[model samples]
Target: MSYTIKPWQDLTIQDDYMFKLVMRRKPICKRMLEKILHVPIRDIRYSDDEKTMKFQYEGKGIRLDVYVADDKGTVYDIEMQVRKPSDDGLYLRTRYYQSMIDMGLLEEGADYDELNPSYIIFICPFEPFDKGRHIYTFRNVCLEDTSLELRDGATKIFLSSVGTADDVTPDVKRFLEYVNGILSNDAFVQEIDQEIKRVKKLEEERVRYMTYAMKMQEERKEGIKEGREAMQHEMQHDLALKMLKDHKPIHEIVRYTELTENQIRKIAAENSNVSFGEESGRNV
Candidate 1:
């Protein structure tokens, strides 16, 4: 896959890396949650410095853009999604993330009832559900009785930048508009814009971005090199197979295809229909 690194100065809050940096400001993050959830957040703390969690037992992991917990034991995992998810992909991802959050909170042999309430929030520039709503909040509910709630303590919220409905607070509206590249006079928006400029001016941040881009480029080059080698290897085996089918001796196939005797024999072994033989007094 090809990756083009955007310049640091060109980054906005919508950028995942920038968003994570901005959310590191606890005041801004807490205010954001309060505005979006329409609740008061006394205080919040980072679950980890990097907000990355790994499910080592399953060999799977997630790198969250922002992960925090409030004084009330409520956990929030915020993500900045630039691309639109296909069908229920995002919803399913929320399910997996919620499970990971629960797994992280519980100790070995811990009671399930001790699980904290968690929220998986995705802020996107594009509408996820095509519902034209500024925000979509989901929770488990009984299908047979719509009024019956499962109260699973797990919630998923999707905020859309292009939403048409007036379903969010003024602060959230300003935030969403800012995400859409529309500058607002709102204090929160101005603060975020200033933070973007401030971060871009940091020498260490510039170096970090540069290093990341260079690393990605190196990995891409390595992948291309490996791909080419793999193609050449497969081509050699194909040529060896064709030569063997043409009644060529093992040594002749080896000299032409640059394949060893063992490799040619292995290919012949797989293709039971192909006749295996040595000819022309060649010893392989």
Candidate 2:
């Protein structure tokens, strides 16, 4: 027996679709973020550029998909990824984004006197770290002595997908399960079904536009081909007439002629300046 292996395509998450679902569940995520970071979220602003919000963790460059700021000048770099990442991979990405955010604190001529707190949140569909069932939070600490603590800088929060739903809040669990695309039970499924419907509608609209664009591209290619064929035919016809005027032999003309026999005969009659039987039929 043979099994077919399918190629994996990157999951395409449209900005509008993501925003709609995320905005709907913003309160839940915000609450969770505040709880995990122990920071008060003065305000949450959704980015206007959808492309920026859709950046993947595996991609190059440092970009914070969702950025949050509090009244205390703390910045939160919030990201949503659909796949599980390794420890090295996780820390590398987190540190990259954190460093970029930290660099923004000191301007060209400004002083590094005041630095705000920055938090990086990785909300994944699968668990990336070992933190048991509930949400896991991490912060900088004294690794050598284990007594000293660096509490002013960056932090990381991982939203795990494993374990029973009873471990987390009802709203948070519902939101997580929805993000994971796992509607195991009826009640949870029903709650997420409405949001799923909205996403589907947006997907359908995107498909329609893609279909129209493809059709237009194909039509344009066909038109160009037709025009080229027509020009080629006219050029061949002119070449054949010139050859006939040179009094080329019939056998040689047949070998090299771009014209049909009837076309050659018409040229021959016109060059001879004689009225054939069908002369009055149509002007040659």
Candidate 3:
């Protein structure tokens, strides 16, 4: 196993776990919503903070940064999204988050109208849309009639760290700059920095951070191991398919391709007749 040392002193606002911890504080979180949202937000309360949400056991889950609500019953899922231009799944991800949030809002038999007004705000450290606009807000709208509105009571906002436009308020821009790792003199940003420093000074938080880093490393290694195993499985299946097409015996296919006899038979059964001038065996 290889090791890489992380710089402790330079840990910035973009660090996912650290940012999550900082946002769990009510004052900091309330100020953040007020600044970026440009609204007089009432008292903020977190029912659950950074809760790992999943559809099923053993399924991939997302660790939400700040899951809180205002006094008026408006649910907010503030996410500090780690930027990745390579993954094109974020748009659907927001949709999924919105659905999950709504599902958890009310009792099982409650009417749909009982759902709270929800916001899934994603703070992306990288410019997502490649536009210069700092903030992008979306809601359901009618495409047939320009004047018609869906008014679904759900809002999805995306905040980009690298945006240069004046679409957002100056305070919002300052917060974005702080999230982008630029040193800031803004009062709210300074408060965030101070809280981060205090959190770092805590013996408990420090120990947790160390353990979190070790867990992250292990997860990374496990992910690499899973990827390699998947690749090898795919290769073996591909070879089994070719051998099946050539009418190779199952025992020989199993010996040479590392596939079980049942698997090889199943693959052959799926694609035994090559009528359309195609390979007779399925790759999977």
Instruction: Give the residue spans of candidate 3 off by over 4 A.
Output: 1-5, 103-113, 272-284
| Clashes per candidate (backbone, < 3 Å) | 0, 0, 0
lDDT by residue for model 2 (1-284), tens: 22222211222222323433443455644665665555577565443322232234754444455666555666677677655565578767777776566665553242555667777777766657554564666777888976787866667777765645356666556656655666555453454455455555676645644564466467667768888998987786666666655555544555575666677667667666432233234333
Global lDDT of each candidate: 0.86, 0.57, 0.79
Off by over 4 Å in 1: 56-58, 107-110, 216-284
Which lDDT value does model 2 have at 227? Answer: 80
User: Per the 3 Å backbone cut-off, how many clashing residue pairs does candidate 2 have?
Assistant: 0
Best model per TM-score: 3
* Tens-digit per-residue lDDT, 169-236, candidate 3: 77788888888777679888889999989888887877787788889889889988998998999999
Span of 10 residues, lowest total lDDT, candidate 3:
274-283
Model 1, residue 155: C-alpha shift (Å): 0.4
Show the colliding residue pairs in model 3.
none
lDDT of 2: 0.57
Q: Please write out the lDDT profile of model 1 over residues 85-185, one tens digit for every residue.
A: 68788778888888778888884344698788899999999989889999999988999998999987889999999999988888899999999999999
Of candidates 3 and 1, the better by lDDT = 1
